[model samples]
Target chain A: MEGSDKFFVVVIVMSIIFTGLGTYLFLIDRKLSRIEKKLKEFRGSKNNDK
Target chain B: MIKSMWWKFLGLALVLYSIIAGLLIDVPALPVIHQTIRNLFYHVSMWFAMFVMLGTSLVYSIRYLSGFRMRDDLMASGAVYTGIFFGLMGLMTGMIWAKFTWGDFWTNDPQLNGAAVSMMAYLAYAVLRGSIDEVAMRARISAVYNIFAFMLLVIFLGVLPRLADSSLHPGKGGNTSTMEGLDMTMRMVFYPAALGWILIACWLLQLHTRRRALIQGIH
Candidate 1:
């Protein structure tokens, strides 16, 4: 590829990587909070039954 | 009390020095806007903090594995949190610098990819900690996983990217260390800026760790 074309290609790749990372973290944070809530509820129920 | 006061004074001095150096330093004529070089103070300092915190976390991880102590786990967690903070700051400052100098907000250069990988590995450390219920089990598993994550960070941030290709980043590939180009006046300021930023990061780590310990003790 030409020099300018190569630079642009690299730039596109970087932008995608950054945006994808931010999105992935946002999704994971949401999912983890849900799982934590369920786990807290389950543990509470177990303690009450004892 | 005396020690704390000493550190406070030292930190103050460092901050003043960094600010002065950043304002006074001269740059040769380049295509990029001049003031953007100021980001170097914040960007490099945060990376130093990240590396230091990650190293500390790795040490605590090993301690937790061998001793099964809750304190070790707490220390590891504190380091990871601090590491995350510095990593984010580094990423932000780097992105801002890139935007100004490169004329884009982001790009897929080898160095940038390596930095992204390092951040992701640190994120995984937090996820791993949350996965386990019991403290002992969590410590054991997180500690083991941390070793892997730390290695990945070393490889991704340190070795692999540098080996890949040329980067616009200074002090990489054939680029000379910009530090040497700086006159004595710049060095006088630059050293203090580095010192000040690292001191603040260390203070944050210590404060968080101490607070966690107090909470644990009270419970």
Candidate 2:
């Protein structure tokens, strides 16, 4: 394969890998935010009982 | 700790720059390496970020040992997790680079073996953390182990490999390919790539720690 062509392949593969990893991170962040919100609401309700 | 988003944005921007620049920038077309030299920005930077994360883990481990705080323990564990992730990525990328350049996916080089050993040592720490049932005992014992393992990691990855008579890796055994000798064009992207990766790893550590804290708080 030509040198520049090999590099282009690398660039595409790397971009895909990074994009996938970034998307996974974003999903995890969203899940954490949902869990945190639920916990806050639960705590607020418990405080209201007192 | 998650209040500000400036550092996260900076990390993202720097990494984006590295990705684009690393590809388009001109590089020294050395024999055998040629375009594969661009792996320097990705593979080497992963190790750099891993070291930073593991160093942070060591500091938090020390703090946990001294203060016995659960938060410090959590931070130390989170950092280790992130560091291990980077280490694995570094190994995978290095192997792929090596396959192209060195004609094999693995080598008998001292540097490669040392890196594998160091990673295994950290994995043992993770297993150690899992075995103990009591929270306080697990934290205290694992904190001590983390400090010991990190010291070994430094020696394995940094010092011992350099002392070897021969190494396939550059910048070792008195080789001239050290970072100081890197072309200015490459350094322009390399430094930022390393720093950006470290920042992103820290961001991941913060997120991991926060999730752990929230879960613990609920329990």
Candidate 3:
């Protein structure tokens, strides 16, 4: 491959990797937010019962 | 602590910018490095992020020792886990860059060996954390070990490598420091890339810590 072609290939590969990683972290963040909301609701209900 | 999402957006934006700029920007077409020099923004940034994460872990470990808070212990563990992830990424990227530039995936360079040793030390820290069954004992013992291991990491990555007679890695021996070698354009992307990766790692750590907290609360 030509030098510019190789560099562009690297750019595509790196973009894919970075985008994939960012998406994974976004999913994890969303999951944690859901779990946290559930925990807060459970605690609030328990406090109301008391 | 993970409530604010603005920093997360900022981190993602900066990283995306770095990815685009690092590739397209003109770089010094030095002998042996050429286009592969762009790996500096990616690979070296991973190590910088790792150091930040590890340093944060050490601070939390010290706090856990002093106050014995479960939250601090969780933060410490989460930081270490994230730090190790970055370290592994750094090593993998380094190996690929080395293969292209240095003609081998692995070499006998002091910096490389020191990095390997430092990673092994952290892995041992993880194993140590896993071995104990008691919560309080595990936290206390692991906190102490984390502090010691972090010191070892500094020595291995920072002190020992520079002390070597020669190294293929830049900024060691007679080679110019990595910062000294970069031009203004590369430096602009490089600094932001490092900061972005560090922020992203911290975000991951915050997520891990929150998950642990939720699990503990459920129990």
| Model 2 per-residue lDDT tens digits across residues B1-219 | 255656875776678778878998989879999988988988999998888988999999999989999999999988988989999999999999999999999998987897788789889989999999999999999999999888876666667666778878777785534585689999999999989898899889988898889978823
- What candidate 1 gets wrong by more than 4 Å, as runs, is A1-50, B174-182
* lDDT tens digits by residue: candidate 1, B1-219: 444446644755576556544544564445675766666665777777787888999999998888887888888889989989998988998888888888887887777777778788879888888888887888888889899878866766666655767777656764435464665655666677777667666666765775666546511
- The TM-score of candidate 1's chain A against the true chain A comes to 0.60
Between 1 and 2, whose TM-score is larger? Answer: 2
Worst 10 residues of 1 chain B by lDDT: B20-29
Structure candidate 3, residue pairs in collision = none
TM-score, chain B, predicted structure 3: 0.94
Better of 2 and 3 by TM-score: 3
Highest DockQ: which candidate?
3
Please tell me which model should have the higher TM-score, number 1 or number 3: 3
Interface RMSD of each: 13.4, 3.4, 3.4
DockQ of the candidate models in sequence: 0.02, 0.30, 0.44
The predicted structure with the larger lDDT, 1 or 2, is: 2
Global fold similarity of model 3 (TM-score): 0.89
In candidate 2, stretches whose alpha carbon ends up further than 4 angstroms from where it belongs are A1-49, B1-3, B174-177
